[model samples]
Target chain A: MTRFANPKKFYNLSQKLIPILGITTLLFFAIGLYFALFHSPADYQQGESVRMMYIHVPAAWFSTLIFVFMATMSGVAFVWRHPLADLLAQEAALIGAIYTSIALITGSLWGKLAWGAYWVWDARLTSVLILLFLYIAYLALKQSMQDKPIASKMLRLLALIGLLNIPIIKGSVQWWTTLHQPPSIIRSLGISIHMSMLIPLLLMAAAFGLFFLTILLMRTQTRLLNIKTIALLKKQDQLDDPSLAA
Target chain B: MHIFSALLKHEFLLLTRNKEIFFTLLLFFGLSLFLFPFALSSDATLLKSFGPGLLWVITIFTILSSVESFYKKDNDNSLLSFYYIQKTPFILVFFTKIIAHFCLMISILMIILPLFGLFFGLELKSIVILSASLLLGTPPLITLIHFAIALTLSTQKTGMLVLVIVLPFIIPILIFGVGTVTFYETGQTLKQPFMFMAAIFLFVFAFVPWIAAYALKESARQ
Candidate 1:
């Protein structure tokens, strides 16, 4: 694992793994969509629109998962002074925010169908909006700094502070009366599990997780290349004038 | 301790020297409170109901304008370097500055609350409860504003940047704060909102200072 911390090793590994992640992502989504949209029975109450759950729930789950990943990468950047970790965190935050946005929009669409209003100032909704703001602020602050190291540390500090909101967001539903639809997917085992619906949802979730890793490694590889390019350029300039090269 | 007090003194002196800004913010607070009657429905009932929130919003902004003095005063002095060498506990600096802010906010509130009461036709009894809530609430106000200000200390426009950053975190405080005065005015018992604000105050007091202290330490190293 430590050896893979080398950008060269990571880059080589990513090159090998992308085709696998790519093919599997395509296969999983295609199969999942087929099973989800066609094979699964419509909800007795929600009718056809309940099909939105397969996408909405997994995306929401992925959004939270991505934030945790971003936070962990932020922690790594702070503790070990890892330059790559900093970049990984920045990218993940943007991606996580996009995921969250999709979740909220889709949730709203579903809410309009289910609740008769497009928006409600509920505990769950307010907390998600707050989470989105935290992501935007983190990204904005990170970009605003001109000093790389200072930006890294400042953003990491911001991320850590912002993390306090995450648990609040997660628990908001439990703590407050809200208009949001409660957990639809994570039911207990004895509750007549439908293997048909469950398999596709789980597959989609796994696919998105692998998809995140694939893109993260690809971005990391590009960043490593950019660093190498700058280093090469500097060395070339030195070679052009040996007297000052030392 | 000496360095922090010195920094605190420097911050206060800087704030005092810019009496125009200090006065402008205070005036903004005053005028903003005046808008309460006009902005809300002119029905005395509706106006009375929402009056406390406008006053609290004004108070928060007045505090925000002054809190930036902590970062801005470092412009000529390089006090962060001075404190770095002095090895001051960052939280001590944080608390001292927040204390100064609380003093300013409270002074502004003291001067204005009665004015808000008289002009807006506020119920006197509820005003008293509202004042009690403000007294309990303002420590956390200073504390969180300092935390937010420190975190965004390096933003190009620190004032607006922090306003954007902290709005969500401040909402819970706003809910309890405004709820206290509004509920009290509605002839209901004010116990719950008061307790809620107190709890929020304690939470921010304990949490925000530590975050601010850490951010200040990080900013100093730069």
Candidate 2:
């Protein structure tokens, strides 16, 4: 892990890994979509709209997963003062925010079909909505500050603080008796969902997870390249004006 | 221990000397409350139903508005770093600040409650419940506001940005704060919501001072 903390090393590692991740993500999406749309039986209750769950659940999972990931990276940065960890956390936030919105929109669409309302103030829905807002807040904090070191420290703290919301989002259904369904995939009484549907759901979740990793690596690479380019430009400017450099 | 007391007293004195904060916030809370009756019809049932939530929301606005005043003077004058350089125990300074601000907010809430109750036609019992919830809930809310202010202390144009960052975290407090009274009006027990508010208060009071002190340190560092 420390080895990858060096930007040059991480950049090289990601360059080799991106193609493999990209291929796997595409393959999983294809297989997942085929199984989800063609093989898995529609819910007796939800009918065709139940299919939306394949995409929705995975996106929702990744949304929360990415936040926890960002928070962990932020914690690493906070404790170790690792600049790379903060950069990874910052990059992860953009993807997390995108995934959160996707979850909300898809969840809203599914709610409209399944529950007869485009929106509800139910516990699960409301908590996830708050999750979206938290992501936006993180991104906004990252952008608002002008000083990099100060902003990085502050954003890491904010990320850690915002982590209080994750458990609430997870337990909203159970804690409040929300309109949203309780856990189905990992229950005490074995898997509640059918295996046919489960396979596709897992596949889609893998695809989404890999998709996040791929994008995170790409964004981190771009940011590092941007930093290097700026440094080189500064060095060139100094070379052009020796007196100013002195 | 003596230093802590002295610091606490000093914070209270500073707050009292800047008496305008209390009045401005009280007036702001009053004016915000005044707008609601006009905006939503004067129907007693509607006001009665909306009163708890409205008061909590307005209180949030007041808290957000007062956040700058709470830290701006010290931050602008570099008092925090001075305290840090003097080895004054940064956490103690922050904790006392939170305590003093909490006391000030409670006093403001106390004065406003009767009028808010009368304006919204709340029963005496409901007023008591609202007070209870506010007492238990406001510590976490205020600490959060201060924490948000500390985080953004070095940023430019932070008024709205602080709100954007903090409001998302305020949802649970709002839910349980309003829940305490609203649930009672509907013939439910207040114990559950009050318990949750207490839990939040305890959790926030324990951790926020440390993190907020760290934030202040970081801001002062640059």
Candidate 3:
């Protein structure tokens, strides 16, 4: 794993892995969508709208998962001073923010069908909304700072602070009298969701997880390339004007 | 301990030198409180109900807006470097700063809360609860704001950036602060919310200084 800490090596590895990951993500999505839409049994009560769970649950799961990943990468960057970890983290913030928004929108739409209100100031809903704000705050702080190294350090600190929210989001339903449902899949009672529904949900979750990784690598690779391009351009400029070498 | 006291005195002196800003923030707090009745109705019942929440919200805004001036003078003069050169621990500097700002916030609140009571016609008990909640709540709020200001010390437009960065974290403080008063009004036990507010204060107090010190150190590097 440390071997890929070098951006160049990571770039080469991602060049080969991207295609494979891309194909698998598409394949998993296809199978997951089939099961989710056609094969899985609908809720006796929720009926057709229960289908929205596949998209909403996976997006919600991945949104939190991506934040965890970003936080870990930021920790790595802070402790080891790994430049690649910093780049990966910076790239992940956008993807994580997008996933968060998708989860929110899809969850709200489902809420309209199931709860009759498009929005409610429930613990679960409010916590997820705060999660979205945390992501945007991370991105905004990153953009506002002019010093690259200091910005990375500060962002790592912010990410660690924001890590406090993940547990809050996970436990909001359990901790408060919320309109949102309690954890059905990961509870100690052992997977309350039926196997038919669980399979597609897990498949979709796996797909979303891989898609996140694929996009993260692609984004990081492009950023790495952009850094190299700037260096090369600076060298070319200096070579053309010898005085500029100073 | 002596170093901490000395640093605290230094911060207080600096704050006094900037009394203009000190009064301006108080004025801002009072004026914002004054506007709420106009925005809503002057109905005493209504304002009384809205009073605690509005007070907490406006306090948060005042903190956010005043954050720029709170740190600007010290940062501009590189007082952090002076402390560093004196071999003062960064965390100590952070603590003294937080203490001074907490005092500043409390003083502002002391002056404004009675006016708030008069305008909203809050009972003595309600005003006392509001004051008690603010006392417990403002430490964590100040620490978070200081952390945000330090983290964004190198950024342009830090006033707004600090708000965006800090507001998410401030949500819990706001919830528990207002919860303390509202629970009392509803005849629920106020102990739970007050305890939560204390826990938040302790958490922010213990951890944020170290993190903010790291930020201050990083900013000084440039």
Could you tell me the lDDT of residue A134 within candidate 3? 91
Model 2: lDDT of residue B213: 86
Model 1 superposed RMSD (Cα): 3.9
Ten-residue segment with the worst summed lDDT in candidate 2 chain B?
A: B81-90
Cα lDDT tens digits, model 3, A122-197, are 6666778888999999999988874366788899999988897456334432333322244332232133788998
Q: List the residue pairs that clash in candidate 1.
A: none
lDDT of 1 at B198: 73
Q: Which scores better on DockQ, 1 or 3?
A: 3
Pairing residues by index, what is the TM-score of model 2? 0.92
In model 1, how large is the Cα lDDT of residue B145? 70
Q: Give me the runs in candidate 1 sitting further than 4 Å from their true place.
A: A169-196, A231-246, B182-196
Ranking by lDDT: 2, 3, 1
lDDT of 1 by residue, B93-211 (tens): 78778776777777778888898888777878878977988898788777777777777665557777677667656766666677677666556677777777777777677677886
DockQ class, candidate 2: medium
Q: Candidate 2 chain B TM?
A: 0.95
> Per-residue lDDT of A76-188 in model 2, one digit per residue for the tens?
99888888998999999999999989999998898788667788666666778888889998888888885366898899989988896566434532344332244342232
Computed on alpha carbons, the lDDT of every model, listed in order, comes to 0.74, 0.84, 0.84
TM-score, model 3 to reference: 0.92
